[model samples]
Target: MRRNDHVILGQERSMSRCTRVWAKFFAFGALCAPLFPVPPAAAQTPAQGLTAAQMREDLAVLGQTWARKDRSFTPEGRERFELALRRTTTQVEGMHPHDFALEVARLAALSGNGHSAAHLPAMPSLPVRLWWFDDGLFVVSARADHAGLVGAKIERIGRASPEEALQRVSQFIPGNDAHRKVESTPFLTNPRALERAGISPGAETVALTVRDRSGTRRQVELHADAEPARGHTWEVLLPEAMDAPGRWVHVLDALQVRPAAFRSETDLEYEWLSSEPRVLYLRSNRIYSVDEVRLDLKLFEMTMKELVDSAPQAVIVDLRYNMGGNYLNTILFAQALPELVAAGGKVLVLTGPVTFSAALVTAAMLEMHGDERVLFMGEVMGDEPRFWAEGDLVQLPHSGIEVRYSDYFHDWGNPCREAACLWATRIFGPKRPISLAPDVRVPTTFADYARGADAVLTAALALALDADVGCAAQRVRGAQAARLATPAGRACVAR
Candidate 1:
């Protein structure tokens, strides 16, 4: 969830240094705020319900702000926004604050920009934390009071099935289908969001139909927690760290071992994996620097230097949990990574649903510059290669809800063409169309996670250790052939 200011392109203006700093400060504060005992400012909305006039004022502000600040806003998008705004304006009179906020979000989602959305402060959330595993939606973690719900597969939310509820909530999530799916998992546990989506009635407690570990189906009523729902953090997905003292209970609390991928909490970490070929495992959780500027770049360079000195046969660059940060700081590393691989060695890049924005950019950069020796493994990236990004947050005066706007466009799929692309190319160099589909797709199943198994890492390790070129080449060729069989992959191949 780390964010950074993107380079301004063409006639597009940049925020003032003070404004950027404050934006980051506030965003970090909001992201890291604890989930209980809402702050005084955020608690104001519940005390005094937002009036229709206030909602109208906020809608106007949202429109004006996006018009002035969002460069990606086109004539077609403006027309859609106006229509949606007029329609929503008619229903605001008797709508609840949560519904109003979602309507505002719907307006932003119309832009089709993943970075754009209205963020409600201190929004009420259910006690249980949900995650979408390969099997289905399941409760991964929960408050101590609802600990029994952990590991239970969610069958239904209220009257709607889990998939139906997710589809309903996805309308308000900005981004491609992949990004929407990633964002919608958390909203499944938000009573206000579910109510706004019509997946659940506006009630004090919502009914959840779940199948427990023993395959027992039952309904459980969960009330909203006292604290507001916070933004998604990848750390919350780590099984080993799920149990927090006496407050929360994790599904894998009984497991004593932790996966190698979940061992590091740092932004950049690298170590040698004990294998036949001597694999170097590098995990980048975020593209951020804590104490020093360009620290990620420095660490990346140092890691590469070590790879050169030791001449490891294989390198794994893990970006599964890296949401994004400043791509400017890591683009050079991406550009240089391909050539650094040892002559007979292979480099496998690990990506997942959280590998997005700046992180996605970096991965694409690597793929575009890399040769056959470089490969990708893990799930599809969070967002599409071509998308809009790079804008600051705007807070509404009346409701204080923050709306993120996007002003810049990025197309990592193709070479520079437009003004924005040209401007970026001037700094980042020529780009090439990139197919983000992994050469080897590895999904994390609930069973793998329940036992602290790192399936993706294990696959990478096996591939790296296999000295037989026939097996490795066959696997890569088969994966590529399967990808070419799909419509999207065929298009990528044609490109």
Candidate 2:
């Protein structure tokens, strides 16, 4: 079913922080002009093929039924969503199921929100896992059957080169940044996505040209495998002594993180990643309570107390693995973060590609009020400002393809953001998200993974060296420590 990949919490050691992120991550793009690939006439099967009429009906229902019900699609995103559905319905008549699903994904992502997705019905992926990084796609993980190809750089998939394949896939990946392409492409490392994009000739297998880790070039006869359902994790690293080793994982990539069981996130956990410059690390793996842990609403106040009492050199809150259970988690934290900034601590919010939804809201809130002391360093976030979100799943009666529609319109404090006309980005080939302007963009590459780099944390500490936390401690609080007030915080409040 179509989904804006809200991942189940899972564990994997990647770029080292023993990360506990929740989502299926990593993907690239493809080059399907018009978004729909032209399926060959002879490729159609009465059993698996969808008719233009059926597609038209689905599109009609999208506007007349689902959109009407999802109401979040109205006022701004409604017309654009309907127009995309209309165009795809006309184009889908002669397409096969995979191709049709591809178009549906694009139409859903066109809503310009991560919470809304046009997902194809679930299918098993190929045995090997393909990764998208700053350079391009690579084989990061493989089942024993295809173990020989692990770490190979994928250059082509069947008929199309990697660049072409990624462009075609990009349109359907929800979110408006290059980071979304990387986070979403792993789900498409299958034969169907390739065939549907007109990049592969069939549904069962595809020819993958890859440059092996040793620099040898080869074509892998990759075949479909019943991919196991992925799992999630919620873990916490206890506070460490000032000179203790960091909890960051130096080995393993994203998929390699396999925590056997979940951990309790009922309380907030803080650690000291470094003592030389004194970086206090806080990991917020989940936003709400789960069966395994006690959900603590006062955790934010406790964290603030900890920050004030300990008086560390800098505060690093790790929200990369946080998959949003409560927006209130963000609200509470946002209300108090200015204290850290006011205390002259360098506050670095360490985020990853999967930092999403309520977690994004939290980050946005911190930035909105966290003053100059705050600096974000990592990949572009999973969601964006002015996007459709808070959704429910809907399935088509005929195709059974599931789609998630937005339930609410979130402003994220950006009045200039217009969700209806949002343009999603794909970092495939030359077209990248020009708007993904992180203060410091760190690359989580395979090479970086191999060297066991906690790139985000590393970037943070490195940035800390340049910051003068000492000078600010001299009590120049009122004059030099003023925050850059966002439009949301600038206006007068009514009693």
Candidate 3:
């Protein structure tokens, strides 16, 4: 599904310098002299190869350090921080580092607060991002060469498969008792497990086994290569690349959304080529857009209206490379779908972890509208609580460590009777604190889809075509199919 616009959540909008804590988190690879494989040290080197205990201690200390600081919120900041905290703590305890980081991103997203983020280490190799759908992995985007795996199931990565790997890594990471998709990654995309398993970029040839649409199994060998360069092209930055597999994939994604003339509108020579009829598929290279000076919402609205108007069914919303922007805008844009708002054509939304904040809101709203008759394909990031915050930062004058505080709160549970009062006075809202709850949860993971795994997407496509309703059920990824097929594998194959 193509998104119509980008919206900033809460309208409480808000970037950045490095501190010692930032350095420690980033340079952890070099700081491991006596942490894990070794011991603690006094020489001032940071720790690496952290165990579960160590990671817990580190997070706790980080929190305590913030609390001890003598900082006060500017009423608004206090409300923002508290609301953010409430929103954050709801999911924080069990989140893996990446998931935790994403939550931090969401908090930061509330105020556009740059200081609030889960620190990450710089990693090479363009990562393969996954979207969870009904416990199945659906590839959202990745570097080129690995495009074939976009719709393939990640039954195996190297010698170990998905289940085995997730279990082993869970010990060191923190997350809810639910799924352990990419959203659950504690740091550096399961740095501990990947390192322990000895996964390396040099291992270009990876073995993959996935089930086909007919329930037959096939084995494929993928050559992991860096995405090729497409000059200094805007399309180059597109979620997929502009060349090779990406070029074709972009065209495919756009076609799925809607067939329109995609042309560039710059006086300067731009490589962004339009499909026919002005359906513009902006390439994903960086977050910066060619129209660098326009309000994101207007641009999105204008473009979407143009494409959708050309052909009602011709519109296909592609967020494959869309990381995230104004979360609120994401939802408002979906309003443009006339079919979705129609009496019975339920909205068909494709979401994943990459779809955060406003994007998540859009999905939720479409689902909520009921009129949109919206159902989602692909994998979802997970249900997140939405709350507004009045961001106020507490900076440790000495260490330059910054902590965020909320000055206000917003709750979805506020009764309509006091809509105005609740909007103005509620932070936790004295009721159910959960912000947004996913009606249907999809467990998208990175390895399976990032490598071009496609069973889930195919399933979604089938649903879209069939207009199947009430298909929502607990998601179990490969486990479900594997179990269902156990008897068939035993009897039919033998027969």
Candidate 4:
């Protein structure tokens, strides 16, 4: 999903610098060399605490780099960063060593670029794993010692409510929209960030208020995990693979969690939601991980062709699980989707908070293509067509904290969303990003989350099942007239 520095050697050579910042570069086209890959070269985190001088040095370098190269940087974001840096440095100068990295990290987040973030060094955390669902934040899982916390609705951590804590932690996260932060909150809600941000008084213990399934609300105290803490994974430290597995899916499918999207063993999966009229369901999790064994243009083409040939009553493509990959793959897939439309099968594209990056582009391409047969449903996109992406990592010297920043403007050929127009304002400028708003805003409320409900997909199929196939194009696209249909009736027509 990332463009390596070698991308500068190919079609990207038209520019004077590297194209993408996703450092986890893969071999695609001319980008043969992986630049800034961090797995092998991790510096040992220091055993001792950091001094104010070291923190200051890190901020200086980070600010300079971001101000110089961040594609989404703006005067407002810069002003906020400078103010936060000045105010926070003075506080960190005398604060505990535990708070140093978080303090500086929050300042980096002031840049407001989704590709840019202040990464925290690995540290001990509470045992429970939390995640945000449409209902609210809840404990998804926890160590054996804290197993009871699972399924409890998270009301507060430390002194702040789950919502309040998320707001504070979001200052250090570079997200284009609220959904981005909402989808990623659990991963970022560690003890280090909580303590440093003053949500928790000390790192040793945390206080929480949660509601059990019975709706009983009470306070609970849990000690942080022990020292020699497990190191952070590449997904946590970097921006590229933020599609780390989450439990909200299981929570949505309360009875038995079905394997679909990223949770599935395979990247591509298809099934029949119903028999009569035949509602087909398909999900492509990640652009790069499509085949499980090997994902390339050929595999994608085959999958699309197969899907179209099935000739179901309707087709539901679940992209909610897709965390992005090669954008070109979307174009390739689009080329083959007309067959499904021509076959009189309606198309419903499902999205959610996790739908991001290249995925957003794919959704935009389908929407902008003006296809009458296609429609989008679910949460608004996490990223946008007009966004700063292809980020490069800049690690701080003292703390080994990684700072990612966008270096390229991904313009989806939209005039109003061009880089120049986006950056030309004091309001709604680059710092204040934009994302695609879905046509049908479907929410997966917990009460309706049957093991196989697939709420969004279910909702789309409900709207589509009774509609005339010939009207699919005009219905969603707002065309003056419905698209033409074949002499053969919509049902019983061989695809």
Candidate with best lDDT: 1
What overall lDDT, based on C-alpha atoms, would model 3 receive against the true structure?
Answer: 0.34
Clashes of each: 1, 31, 80, 6
lDDT of 2: 0.53
Alpha carbon lDDT of each predicted model: 0.68, 0.53, 0.34, 0.55
Cα error, candidate 1, residue 184 (Å): 0.8
Show the lowest summed lDDT stretch of 10 residues, model 3: 34-43
Per-residue lDDT tens digits for candidate 3, residues 316-385, read 2333223333332223344455342323333445555444333444454444443325555555432233
In candidate 3 the C-alpha lDDT for residue 195 amounts to 43
Q: Estimate each model's TM-score.
A: 0.82, 0.67, 0.42, 0.73
Across 1-495, the per-residue lDDT of candidate 4 in tens digits comes to 011011101111121112122112323422422111122233344446777788788767876775566667688877877777677666656655456766655666666665566555555677666656678876655554665666688888889877778776776666666544643453334676677667888777888999976789989998777532222221221111225442212232233323233233234555554344566566665554423233433334344334544556676777875667655445545545545543566677898776766666666665544356677899877665556666577877877777767665655435445544423222212232233577788886544332333457556756656644333322221111111133432232222
Worst 10 residues of 4 by lDDT: 1-10
Clashing pairs in 1: 413-433
Q: For candidate 1, what is the lDDT?
A: 0.68
User: Least lDDT summed over 10 consecutive residues: which range in candidate 1?
Assistant: 1-10
Residue 304 CA displacement from its true place in model 3, Å: 7.7
Give a tens-digit lDDT track for model 2, residues 1-495: 111111222221122221111111210111211111111111112237567778777667666666665644445666787777767766775677666666667777665666676655555567666556667776655654566776788887888777778777676776666445654454457577677667788778878888987899988786776543122211111111225332222114332321111122422455444434445556665665444322333343344344555556676666766656555434546656656543566778766666776676667666666656677777777666556555566776566666777655555544333444222211111121123236777766667554334556556655554533322221111111122132321221100
- Alpha-carbon RMSD, each predicted model: 11.1, 14.7, 16.3, 10.6
> What digit string (tens of lDDT, one per residue) describes model 1 on residues 259-352?
6565545566665553234566777766665443343334444543465556667878888888787665566577666677667878899998
